[model samples]
Target chain A: MDDLDLDHESVYDGLLGGDSSQWAFGTDFEDPLAGVDTMIPAGVDGAALAAYCLMLGDDALIYAHRLSEWTSNAPDLEDDIALANIALDLLGQARLLLARAAAADASVVPQMPEGSPVPPEDALAFFRDEHAFRNMGYVEALNGDFAVTIVRLLLFSSHRLALLQRLATSVDPVLSAIAAKGVKEVTYHRDYAGRWFVTLAGGTEESRRRLVAGLRTVWPTYAELSRSTQVETLASEQRFGVDPAVLTEEVDAVVDHVLAMAALERPDLPPSGTGPMGRIGRHTEEMGHLLAEMQVVARAHPLGKW
Target chain B: MTTLAAGRTRAREIAGTVVDPEMPMLTLVDLGVLRDVTESEVGVSVTITPTYSGCPAMATMRDDLVHALSDAGYAEVEVKVSLSPAWSSDWITAEGRRKLRAHGLSAPGPSPTGPVQLSLAPVRRAIDCPRCGSADVRLTSEFGPTACKALYQCNDCLEPFEHVKEI
Candidate 1:
């Protein structure tokens, strides 16, 4: 009953504690690795594997957040549901990836009570500092128009589809398993966004202009595909990851084909936050703000079960 | 009584009775989401696969499986998820298709195989309406309420129906 404790920022300090979801069993649900093998493939450095997983997880996490924003805001109900469904698919991928990371390197997970219902996936998602996130510039960017979402999603999924396809044969059983499922999901995602990209480009002149502008804004994310980070290189060397170099040709073919069909010109622009920028703990101001909103409730009640 | 015993084993029968949370008309077994049920020395374990990666229903299915088995005189019940060989729409049982049609939702056709090739147009499929059996159904959206379905409007019946889209 700390009435007039106006300086306190913790929401859970109040009489009601917090929402039902903050309780462990509500949305936090069960373990992502319920029955899967948690063993790290031999010879693979656990920490390195964890970092790789975080990169993939963070990309999905941030992009899903951006896509979820379109829920009530899309032009049509079907498009709204379509975007939301795609976001849900990415969110599921993030959950499994984050859980895999926590399983590989326990040191990275935030400490929690024994037998706590709050899953490790939630812990990594909620407790990590903004600088700890490893998502790319494309995923962390603020939403533009609906066309921008389509452009960005198309590029991300095109590259991701290629990468995941390669990862399906990984030596790590868990990563391979996750990738096998992910390939199927991202295929639909790439197709959805690719179709939308074509539609918008061929639609009204205004929509065409918006899509071009959207492409320019998210071009940095696609450009980053040309550079391979150290972890990615190492992981690829170990047979559990794909080098960014290899994805370039296939991704280019897919994107170029889509753009050609739409009669849209490729934006000639410099890549922002190039090389190891986002994945190496460096990010734009957008990421900090996004993490702030996404983690606010969970961070406020770190021990709040749900 | 003796004749009925020729059906599926008790554990599987009970587990299969659990319905899908998103589509209640179809049981887990009918949808082919239920992969396996095996009895070991430890207990009876059930295996299920997700129709979509981000499917929220997977958790419910696992919980339902555990509850169904636990109530069926098995002390220990475990549910496992397998992601390999990814679940396909073609896996839907024949009975599952019958149940779906009976419930007015069009069942999925064959799933696309081979490497994914980008298609610019919205997905085109040869779907017949479950209600009126009309072949002239237009796709309203490639995605529906859940990840596994698509929204369609039958030209003949003029009623909106959901089709479990082929993966």
Candidate 2:
């Protein structure tokens, strides 16, 4: 408020306005596609495309949050940065994909109070109810341990990388554009987790045991990731998305190869459930808790801008 | 130059002067994030691309550009982000590479093209120590202090440095 405060705000104060770039309590949300043409192609199914985007976006957002839980909990500093970096990459993907979904169907965005600084993408992320979230349960399950997280990341990123590689050729420009960017990022994520998979498996006796257990812990929900929900099928039929079912072969080859390197057998655990779980809003009770931590600040400060 | 031509030049000059908040050694022009700047009816429009899908530096980049241009006397300014040609470490200008090395940061190598091979083995990057110029630099971690960088330690010089990762 005073001249001294203005002058002492570091080098930024010398500019036209002092340091508006600073973040408040959380990331400052803006339109991820602010400058790009966001028009949905006429031939594309708006509803299906929106649902598909939300599906992928929700998965990334939730998975990123779970990864963040390992921020200070990783076994080492290097692992900590690696996990958080991967989380940041996915969060970026989520922002753009959610923005794409809102562009396709404004109705998908949840309502917020007046004067809320939250954008469409942020609103979709924070305001939606748990059942309304379209993320698969594979990512929503609580983290078991460092090994469990690495296993989850390996599975999710492998599956997502395959999906994005095909989605890059989608008829929809935005979807294709998003997919192209995501492919490069998820490549690093998959590679990181895959290496860890092999390392942990081949490590000390206790590490090998934990690694095998981690695989078993997540195998029950493996079926959910490969099962194509109705929206995915619709989007694929409309040329706006890729169905998860088609990615099964590609993802399996990668996972199998990694497991072979680790000298570990594939867990023969049965599928947790038969068909379309999370995509239809069916999720574990813990998703509510994840959303509570993620959304509480936004909901509490709908009108608070810093 | 004509009035409009002069204005265009002036607008671009102001934009070119702004540096990245995180990596201040390189101007936005040096960094490929600044896509283009053009004069428009209302004012001038600037377009940029994000280095990564979830780069936190984007907000600062936009805010800095707006402040710099406004201070330079642009009446109206608009900043836009494009995602079509996703940013690559290869986009860093030649001068930007020099700046990065001069500041003890390893510049990224040529980006990978075509299908990205999935190797469980660590990525083998043939990099030299920025400080010692020794080819014996080894990778410490694939991820680093920021999302855009990776940690490396030079075996010959015994110094740790960050490499601007190739996305």
Candidate 3:
């Protein structure tokens, strides 16, 4: 890992890899596939659609909740708002993605014998039973040293941002729209973590050491994100989703750069097997505790509107 | 004036005074979140956009909007939140941005695009030192005292300042 110095120049230096190119910020453009009116295509697999969405949405929601925990506990008062803003962005993405998943699933599931309105809350609530959340294992791991947290964030956000960038062109309008806005948020998030990675990796020997240990702790769980599930096939059929396998190279390149920049070595640990089932709801013990805290009040007062 | 028109005129007067919970100096109307005011048979309905999704203070703002309308003699009122087009710093009025600057904070710049070089643009491009009119400033951190602002230090005035992070 390359040691980054905060003393010689501003931290923003080289954040974009010294690229002189300007990056557009918002996802407010007109849709490329706009005007083609078409019915749902043949053999359209709705279950796969719901599963993929659950994977994306659950990741956003759980991670947003985790990030929110850092509020007021950040190293500086400013970071409180920064982290909170990032969390809010993630929450917004989760709401839209989850809503999209629910809407897509609703289309396929056999409705009640008679027509009945299925409220949004119920749609969101009924999807999971603990063995199917395919979020990157990085976010759910117990909060580790700050250096480690930044590394994990850097890894996750870059991957997510890249994923969203590809999804923005999806045949599904809803998915495309959500991905469009999401790309910007994820970009900011990735940069924030990357700048910090450079700072810590280059700051001091102690910061450097902690970053390495943090990388090892978080790296094992990342394999789960790279695996291709059946959902990817359904998404590809729909024409907007990227093959998760294709993204491995991009993810690896960035991760290697950051790890190298941080003056840390990627651990050569053999992969401990874990994949798609986690996103389907088989979360580790940490998730149960997190959900207990997150869902407690809402569950206790079911149907209670604030 | 007609009775319906008269009621609307008064309701607008009351809503005009509600301040933003985040940026205290600016009114909600100044931030452009408060949208339409519709008078139904039951009561008056006020629509607004949230600055960020899941903002806890929105409930408080809604309550405040209702109370203020009631205090002004409009008994029935409804507050609606919309997320379409989302929220933009561009929605913030010029006067609100001025007030933010007066309060020692820089207004947000436009959101960046595709790939950005922060060094090329310079840290204080969108910011002007409210205390001193100098343009030479450097951002020390993206996180500021508030979520909206980034921490900046002025080169000329030698003062640490906050620049609003453009969403």
Least well predicted 10-residue stretch by lDDT in candidate 1 chain A: A18-27
Candidate 1 local Cα displacement, residue A114, angstroms: 6.6
* Model 2 chain A lowest lDDT segment of ten: A20-29
Please give, for residues A148-231, the per-residue lDDT of candidate 3 as tens digits. 778778878878877887888777656666676676567667878887777777878898788777777777777766777667
Number of the top DockQ candidate: 2
The digit string of per-residue lDDT tens for model 2 on A51-167 reads: 999999999999999889989988999999999999999999999999989999999998878757779998898888898999988888898888888888888889999999999
Ranking of predictions according to DockQ: 2, 1, 3
Model 3 lDDT, residue A280, Cα: 46
Candidate 3 Cα misplacement greater than 4 A, ranges? A1-49, A103-129, A132-134, A240-242, A263-267, A303-306, B1-19, B27-50, B57-86, B115-126, B134-140, B144-146, B153-161
What digit string (tens of lDDT, one per residue) describes model 2 on residues B1-167?
A: 48888888888889999898789999998888888899876799999998889888888888778878887878898999988888888899999999999999999999889877887887799889999999988888999988889999999889999999987
TM-score of chain B of each: 0.92, 0.96, 0.83
Q: Could you tell me the fnat of model 2? A: 0.78
**What TM value does model 3 have?**
0.72
The CAPRI category of model 2 is medium
Residue range A1-306, candidate 1, lDDT tens digits = 339464322344354342322222333368877888889888898898999999999889999998998989999999999999999999999999999999999998878666545678898998888788887776888778898888889998999999998888988988898888888788889999998899888999998899888888887667886577899989998888778788898899999999899897777887665476888888888888888889899867655544
RMSD of 2: 3.6
Candidate 1 residues lying further than 4 Å off, grouped into runs, are A1-28, A113-116, B1-8
Per-candidate TM-score against the hidden true structure: 0.91, 0.94, 0.72
For model 3 the local lDDT of residue A71 reads 83
On a 0 to 100 scale, what is the lDDT of residue A96 in model 3?
61
